[model samples]
Target: MKINWKLKLGSRKFWALIAGVATSILAAGGAGDDTTLKVTGIIGAVGSCVVYMLAEAYTDAGNSGGSESKDSAAE
Candidate 1:
């Protein structure tokens, strides 16, 4: 099967699902509230960064004729 990594990585729902699963697993393993919260926060922060970077890259590519963004051009 083919996967769209760029789109998938930029999705909030995808990241939230990951955080939810991680939180559930952590809680099941007896992790403390603070630890779980930290993990969740990190995940959210990283997810936001990923989305921002993808957006910026796509925007730059669109604005610059995909000169430096061959990876995001057409595929």
Candidate 2:
């Protein structure tokens, strides 16, 4: 199957958003008090869930054979 770079890139953005949110949560937690910890943890959990959901959606959208690129590029 031919790979669709555009769709793959869109999926990458969703993952990137998740990472950015997680990073922000971590930074907030490190500098925060108890309330901050709760908020940040919640944010991180929500962000992680969003990432997982997006990954599922992306996978359901179809593989597009990007898995081959991912495997070969590492070799």
Instruction: Identify the leading candidate in terms of lDDT.
Output: 1
List the candidate 2 regions with Cα displacement exceeding 4 Å. 1-32, 63-75
**lDDT, candidate 2, 9-28, per-residue tens:** 44646556655676677676
lDDT of each: 0.93, 0.64
For each candidate in turn, give its C-alpha RMSD to the true structure in angstroms: 6.4, 10.9
Q: What is the RMSD, in Å, between candidate 2 and the native fold over all Cα? A: 10.9
| TM-scores of the candidates in the order shown | 0.83, 0.43
CA displacement after TM-score superposition, residue 52 of candidate 2 (Å): 0.4
**After superposition on all CA atoms, how large is the RMSD of candidate 1?**
6.4
User: Candidate 1: TM-score?
Assistant: 0.83
lDDT, residue 54, candidate 2: 63
Model 1 global lDDT (CA atoms, 0 to 1): 0.93
